[model samples]
Target: MFIRTESFSQYIRQYPVVSTLIALNVVIYLLSLLPFIGDPIRNFGVGSNYMIAQGEYWRLVTPMFLHAGIMHLLFNMFSLFIFGPELEKVAGKARFLTVYFLAGIFGDIATFFVYDSSYLHVGASGAIFGIFGAFGALVYYTKKMLPQLRQIILPIIVLSVVMTFIGPNINAAAHIAGLVVGFLIGLSIFHPKRIISWRKPKLKVVQKR
Candidate 1:
């Protein structure tokens, strides 16, 4: 009999950093299920307008990493997995992480300001939108090379718009805010680097022997 090995590790190596982030988010969510930690988890991300208004400003960012249920977490993670690797490869790990967190914060802050005292919200859509923003920026910047990206992205944007109107308990403000912030940050990353002139080396021809 022949032995066969199976491992997704090799496939994941191309995006080690993104994998790490996904792992961290999953771990944190799992931890939130414990009886002792469950309530505290709500404080971190329940989207309670009251808590947010009461000066728990940190909640805006925290909520992005925390989800309300298994389905919620899975959906967000699925989207992240689908889109994050490409964006991370383009933006680089550090910048990609920055954009994710900033977009999440933007979403949270927008929710905090827009929703009333009774409503509470939580999910990773904000960060996902940020990734979408970066994707749009990438398509725009590389229009010469990848004009097709715009066409692909346009349908997704339209679907998201329709979802905002039809989906119940959706936080439309946060989504818009995250998209704007992500786009701005994405655009900023493309600014031309300062040029540095290099001294030319002189070459001399040797006399034929």
Candidate 2:
């Protein structure tokens, strides 16, 4: 009982990291909406092959927090809300950030190489997709949750992929890149027992007379 209780507490504690990520993205989105900021901010976002070729490497990282518009922002934030906290709980704060950005940046890298010179993209979806992939990994790694994951997350993933292909202006490469990177990270990083407890054998108290 005590172990379970402690596990729950640790899980709850991980939420603030995810919340901070959401807050940063929201704040950046709000900043992007300012009168003069829009144009300048777009420069920070992922762009066509030419833009990256011109030494705008920062675009790889910045696009993770950039959203095109309010609807885009809301949709991505909703995804973050759904996936971030749970992932943070499992991955812990540092690994969660690593998974998020590593996948997101790799998504940008993929877009850089795969798409046409005119293609441009922004939004948290790539990173969020990474989170989704992590969730999928978590589901698979956790034996008890396999049934629930198959019933829930699997369908959502498939639907999301279908929607991405059909959706206008979607960066399919970014989505695919993030998903792949995230899954690999999950495979390497996720370990259930560490989160639960690292129990050390209590020394047997031999009362030496």
Candidate 3:
């Protein structure tokens, strides 16, 4: 299910929401690379506890699209690209957007409350973790029916949580918060019944009586 076999055009067509999000991230990242406007864009968009406290509320949402560097952009966008389409397929466009943005905003909100006023962070790791959490919820709801999903999803969650704590300069608070929010949203909204088998049904020929 995680494997993407779609062509570039097909991918864009099939997963428009994911494609738009990836495009937005890339466009914002490119804008941030500009010598003149780059620093300004980052300064304005980055999630800053001080600025947030000072009433710059949009920072929460903006940082979802902002990135500190090309690597940061690539990593987050890649994560979105890989995991997003499936969720989008399951959740539909609206719920998927709700999950993505809410998870990200809540992550920023968590960071705001957890860190001191001097704290500054930029990246979509929180949102990406949110996607992971949504997958976790899928695994949870479908465990009895889809036992194989545990093997596929559990390790990714475990490894991601481990890396979150051990990795330098990582924002554990946002990641954890986003994950929780995503999982909760998933549990509340996602029905196990919505999950359908990806394999094509085989047709059988009946012998004439």
In candidate 3, what residue range of length 10 has the lowest lDDT sum? 191-200
Which is the better candidate, 2 or 3, if ranked by TM-score?
3
Residues 1-209 of candidate 3 have per-residue lDDT tens digits of 88899999999999999999999999988988899998998888989999999999999999989887777788889889999999999888988888899999999999999999999998888888888888899888888887777788889889989999999998999999999998998886665444443344778999999
lDDT of 2 at 36: 89
Task: Evaluate model 3: give its TM-score.
Answer: 0.90
lDDT winner: 3
Q: List model 2 lDDT by residue over 102-172, tens digit each.
A: 98989899999998777788887889889878777776777485676656777777888889899998999
- Give the clashing pairs for model 3: none
Worst 10 residues of 2 by lDDT: 1-10
TM-scores for all predictions = 0.82, 0.82, 0.90
- Go through the candidates in order and give each one's C-alpha lDDT: 0.76, 0.78, 0.89
Predicted structure 1: lDDT: 0.76
Can you write out model 1's per-residue Cα lDDT over 1-209, one digit (the tens) per residue? 01113246853787776677778778878988989887787666666779877887777777777777898889888778777887777677888988888998888888877878887888878888888887767666777777677777767766876787699877898788788788888887644341111124568989998
| Candidate with maximal TM-score | 3
Q: Predictions ranked by TM-score, top down?
A: 3, 2, 1
Each prediction's RMSD over C-alphas, in Å, is 7.1, 5.3, 6.2
Per-residue error at 100 for model 1, in Å? 0.5
| TM-score: the better of candidates 1 and 3 | 3
